[model samples]
Target: MKNNLTKLVKKANAGDKQSLELVILEINDLIYNLSLKMLLFPEDAKDATQEILIKVITHLSTFHYQSQFTTWVYRIATNYLITYKGKKSKEFAMPFKEYAVLIDSGQSDTVSYAKNAGELALLEEEVKVSCTQGLLLCLNSSDRLVYILAEILEFSSKEGAAILTITPDNFRKKLSRSRQKIRNFLTNKCGLVNSENPCRCHKKIDFLTHQKVINPNNLRFAQFTKRSIDLVDQIGDLEKAIAIYRATPAIPAPETIMKTIKETILIT
Candidate 1:
């Protein structure tokens, strides 16, 4: 797949319009998913994904095949996300202490917006994904990026370091610190990580819905997910706290993103 992407990139760099479109098609989901995880909002993710795609396309000639095409793409994507100061980034720029207080403050009132079991299940899933993604925001952008690459995306330390232009040992240290921070919070506050914890996804659904933090009519995370992360075979051995992120469904890029990219390319 990397080889094929490299070939497409080469063709696109040589002015093959079809290959350029194909290149966008191949990496759209990847860029969108990473952006969504980093930004924690679909609209913000969409906006950031478009910008990053434009960067990749505009800088196509700079890729000299010294690294894997995907790695190069990741380097570009990660750098953009780390420095991105989007609306949600500012809103969610909080320490773990503040976030933990927010989590603990939720009411346990039972409010059912769902008419049936399936709808109720979806709402619960929405809370789980939203809550976990929110936890990620507690980490600063740099640590958040490290945790996302090392845990959610499962990149090796060396690979992550290379993408971030850091040494492997430095990458590992950041990942360890970030991982422990999240684990500590989840272990104390999240029921999924510890059965003794008071916070449950189902219990928070009512509070979150009433607070307008999550809408059953328009779920941001659960609506796009086809399968839970636990259903995937590769995550069985991962620690539960770390695995919670993997549970986020692989959200695809917006359907019109390709058309928009093509038009933008033509204009530029």
Candidate 2:
């Protein structure tokens, strides 16, 4: 991988068309995955990914050899997200917090959006994505990025610090605080992580269905081709809730952005 990046960097710098295309293909997944996690909506993620790639390609000549290409690329991506203030549309029409309140209240009118148990299971998984992504937005951008990089992306403190242009110690400290904050929220609100919690996926299905937060006919987050991101085997001493958060399957990059990037590279 390192050698391939080195070769691609050299060729791309020399304005080699095929090498530039390969570079886009190789790095698009990393950039898009991070974008989707940070932006929380597919359209927003796609836009952010395209912009970040443009910046990376345009500034490739300025990238020093002091850091790995991936580190430099992520630095560009992270900085963009940190300053990005775009508003993303909510996955559900009603906020997940409000849904939680309705769940707490006995006033929710039950409706089954899913026709069968199997479909309901898929919808439940989608709910997990919606709930978790909503919680991520609650954090300030920097903290959210730290949590995602250190926990979900599994970046080392050094690598994360490099990407954020911070000291490793600073990275660890922020990661610790982010971890604690997310854990507190999940333990108090997520039934899957804490059985004592009142919020259960099954319990919310009816409320979510009634509100059109999730449609059984049109599931977004859950897909047949991909499995839920699982970190069960990668579990560490970190909070169980965080482990679950890290385990959530990352959204796939859209083909549209990938094609656009290739076209842009070829034209340039």
Q: Write the per-residue lDDT of candidate 1 for residues 18-135, one digit (tens) a residue.
A: 8988898999999998988888888889889999999999899999999998899989999999989778656866888998887888657575787886887788788888888888
TM-score to true structure, per model: 0.95, 0.87
Q: Tens-digit lDDT track for model 2 on 1-268? A: 9878978988988888788778878889899888777766777788889999999888988876777888889999999988775556334324436644654653323436666767766876777776676677666779889988988898999999989999999999999888887787677777767778777666677666666656677776777323343343366676668666666765668889978876786674
Assess the local accuracy of residue 139 in candidate 2 as a C-alpha lDDT between 0 and 100.
67
TM-score of 2: 0.87
Provide the clashing-pair count of each candidate structure.
0, 2
RMSD of 1: 1.8
lDDT of each: 0.85, 0.75
Among residues 3 or more apart in sequence or in different chains, the pairs in candidate 1 whose N, CA or C atoms overlap within 3 Å are none
